[model samples]
Target: MGGGLTLDGLNRQPQIGNTRLQAPIGLAPFNSGMFGQDGSIGTDGLSFYRSFCNDRLGLLCVGGLAVAAAGRANRSSMCLDRDERAHGLRLVCETAHAAGVKVAVQIEHAGRQTGPHETGLPSVAATAAPCPVVGGSPSALSLGEISLIVDQFVHTAEIAARAGADLIEVHAAHGYLLSGFLSAATNTRQDRYGGNLERRFRIVHEIVTRAHAAVGHRIGIRINVHEDLPGGMTPDQAIAGLRNLRTKLAYISISGGMYTRARDVIIPRRTLSRALWRDQAATVRTELGVPVMIAGNIDTPELAASLLEHNVSDVVLFGRSLLADPDMLISATTGRQIQPCTDCGQCKYHTKGYPHIYCPFHPTLRPLRSTWKRRRTD
Candidate 1:
């Protein structure tokens, strides 16, 4: 009668790994180099996250920090190793920490997906192959080189840990380096890192286990249960790999598609089935003993809540939806109309050359202003 009311009913506390997220709704890594970095080389990046992170959103998948020079998606992206360039990343972690929001650095290598124009380096992959989108034959990683890349991921996780991140997510999805190794269409090797599920997933398995060994209970994975390529790893194969990695992982987020069929990966067209990976995630939760998260078109709060209620997934993820409205979770909890994502799919295209992720419905992101002279004026 006297105090303020609280929005209830939604399950706010969903535990993933050792970190208990304040809400079941988590912000997927929106885009690398475009949310927080102001003074960095990519000056136009990294503008909205401090406020976005401060919002009711729970998990923050802060991308942009490349594990090593070879992994750099572009020059604008953040690097965890360089102490001088640590400001943007530290700001992200500190901001999330202050808000009691869990943060995970989505450490990834672009692999053959990145072109020389972006990283000033030749594209590399699980094998010396070319993706459907990029040109120039990628240098196949050697055994020693593969070991070195694993070291890079582990070191980056260590950097994230010291930077105050709560978890480390290995980005083995969306046709990245590790994903290539796991896909039959990509990897043609005969070594331990190739062939069947166990061998094909050796790299990711090593990265997750080693990162966990380094960071303890703070390591997880984001992977495609099935790559959309015709000859790629199937859902059955992907599920088998997840089964083995479950013990080593704190949690897993399921995604699909590779670079060739990028639309299938991000689901640009509306005709695709919504919440594409929930079924597989449900299987993971029911059969395997791993906490699973499903991301795709589970846009509305009602649907997200319904999915969680039915035990389809342990966590509900929003990418494009939240990019349109950062406070979608708050609106969902409060029974307000969650802003609908038009799904025009301009955000992904924007990331191709531009340095921002904006909803096609809302194209412009107004930088936060300060009445007092601000540090962002640079």
Candidate 2:
């Protein structure tokens, strides 16, 4: 491996914080788009993650927890803005921890990707430019506003820590608020928070530094290796930016793309090559000096194992694969037949206003979907 570490087998356990993963495989955070009105995870949300815990995941990342109301990516984005929300969040942690899996709550801010209709606040970003995908002229964040966001991230980290989470994942990918500031394509301010690459990463550096002081190595980060848009965040730029925060992160999850190219890069299709971001992730692990977790079309256990065998990434994160088959980890461990994800658009482009997520190819999920459909109109 890059750090002189060798993976003897795919079943090796990697330690993060006080939890040791059962295996090197983990569940990348997936937002159900079904949070309560205040962005809290209710009983339904707890059940959603609880079901995945029974499947033998090493780490379960509860995702899309907005740091503030103004940062909500959509109407369904969950929040950690209030202390009361920790009750449900703690329940999620307890459920996963009981299943022998560590939990990390993904703290994020959507930036210009959201609008007043969704957050009941004006869209704000690193710049006033309109996002190509979510059309709107967002107000450029002032220096004071930027400082507030950094504080919000710290506050959220405290709540997640108090709620018994093992780790807090800072979301700085997929064209979100922090991602916007890190990219020259989105951030063009002349102040200290912008201009040079170091300046661009200043916001993330500050947040991670402050959060680390509070929670120590309990902080992990997810970031894009490439943003895909012209003039967007590049691999070299991403690596350099991450160099500023690696010491504080427990691990780094490497992913790519933003809202503009979500279909091809973010959710990806069957036509795209498998292990799409493997090379970039490998590069990061080699150069960034931090344990790396990679996701993006890594569908099979064999493929996931190869990435570890070759010293590409420390952990393999499965998004659509686990959704397609919750028993995937069990099958991978026991050499049972693992179900395949057909890359149907049902779980990708179609679940916008839906209350729940279901994989059409999942044998047992069709009836649940039918039940949701019946209730939607009732």
Tell me, by TM-score, which candidate is best. 2
Model 1 misses residue 358 by how many Å?
A: 2.5
Question: What's the TM-score of each model vs. the native?
Answer: 0.87, 0.92
What is the lDDT for 213 in model 1?
Answer: 87
Worst 10 residues of 1 by lDDT: 368-377
Per-residue lDDT for 287-359 in model 1, tens only?
Answer: 7777777788777766777777777777777777877877777776567776677766556633444444545
Model 1: colliding residue pairs = 34-46, 35-46, 35-47, 36-46
**Superposition-based RMSD of candidate 2 using all C-alpha atoms, in angstroms:** 3.5
lDDT of each: 0.72, 0.81
Model 2 misplaced stretches (Cα beyond 4 Å): 1-8, 38-43, 261-263, 349-352, 361-365, 373-378
Among all candidates shown, the one with the greatest lDDT: 2
Give the clashing pairs for model 2.
none
